[model samples]
Target: MDTSASPLSQEDFEEIARAAARTNESVRLEFLDGKIREKAVPDGYHGRIIEWLTKVCLQARPELWLYGDQGLHVEAYRRGNARPDGCLARSGAFEGAGEWASTEDVEMVVEVTSRDRDTNQRDRVDKSAAYAAAAIPVYLLVDRGNQSVKVHSEPEGGRYAKVNEVAFGKSVSLPEPVGFELDTAPLLGWVG
Candidate 1:
């Protein structure tokens, strides 16, 4: 759970995305096959989920490196890149100079649902597909809107074939990339 308060500035990669996305709006842009997807700033609940998920990630043994706002490359999926709300990767995966991590560098990706249909759709469908397409072992979706946590696994044909969904008070197990039994009970109060 090594977190940072480093100010968010437009790094070279972001600059390239800005130029590539062809927009000046203050929205997060994801590049995929020369097309850009816009993601608005998350609201309070979404932000809190990032903090909470990071906390859970850090508690796991053999501590993997955690990231809150880092972008992961899914170039296998038409040169795509996604910034999950929280992510865990094997240590030293980012040793060299690189703004984005390749799919293989990541263990799992987390996405907290934002308050909108578009964001919900992207988190559940688009991003999931991209992650699966890139063969990321785990994809966790925190649906504050639905009051549940959905864990997708067994990537196959651009989608995860296995899924385990549970409500806030229940628990979900994250395998492989993250071998942890994440308790969602604490989220009940905040999620409500």
Candidate 2:
């Protein structure tokens, strides 16, 4: 309910997010600092990046599913649920069609940074460590404000060993859970 609590109850935040996600038409909800926040999707810029990512990944790996602005909960950490801009997950016989991704289910997570440096920092710093701790490989940050993208990989003991930053005109590829690459020029073009 408040933003000052530690290890906030997932049930509380999840219920709030679930309600907001169902009713709010323009924004998606996620919990941070024990409070639920709504995030607006930038259609031309951020949405385009999600579209391109989905198109490319689905074309190469038809069995894999790509989702944008979807909620993922790492129950083990009581971090509540986080809504990444885009995410990739491999399919399996045991996985269902409408289930949330478990720690082992997610492959890659991407976040497109807005003008807010706080958001950029949160995505790049806090969630980066959270993903590593959850053992999710390949965390990508699309930083439109700086005309750059950052790729984090090689997770070892709750942190990444390498972080590769690519500029707007450059191309970058993910290293694990499936090697996927993209050109940054097209994705960052809509920023302006």
TM-scores, each model vs. reference? 0.82, 0.83
**For model 2, what is the error of residue 144's alpha carbon versus the real structure, in angstroms, after optimal superposition?**
0.6
* lDDT top scorer: 1
lDDT of 2 by residue, 88-179 (tens): 87655225634345656678888887655367546766678767777778888877777788898987777888899988888888787758
Error of 2 at 1 (Å): 6.5
Candidate 1 least-lDDT 10 residues = 1-10
Collision count for each candidate, in order:
0, 0
lDDT, candidate 1, at 191: 73
Colliding pairs, model 2: none
Per-residue lDDT of candidate 1, residues 52-86 (tens digit): 77767877745576677677778776567677887
Off by over 4 Å in 2: 33-35, 91-100
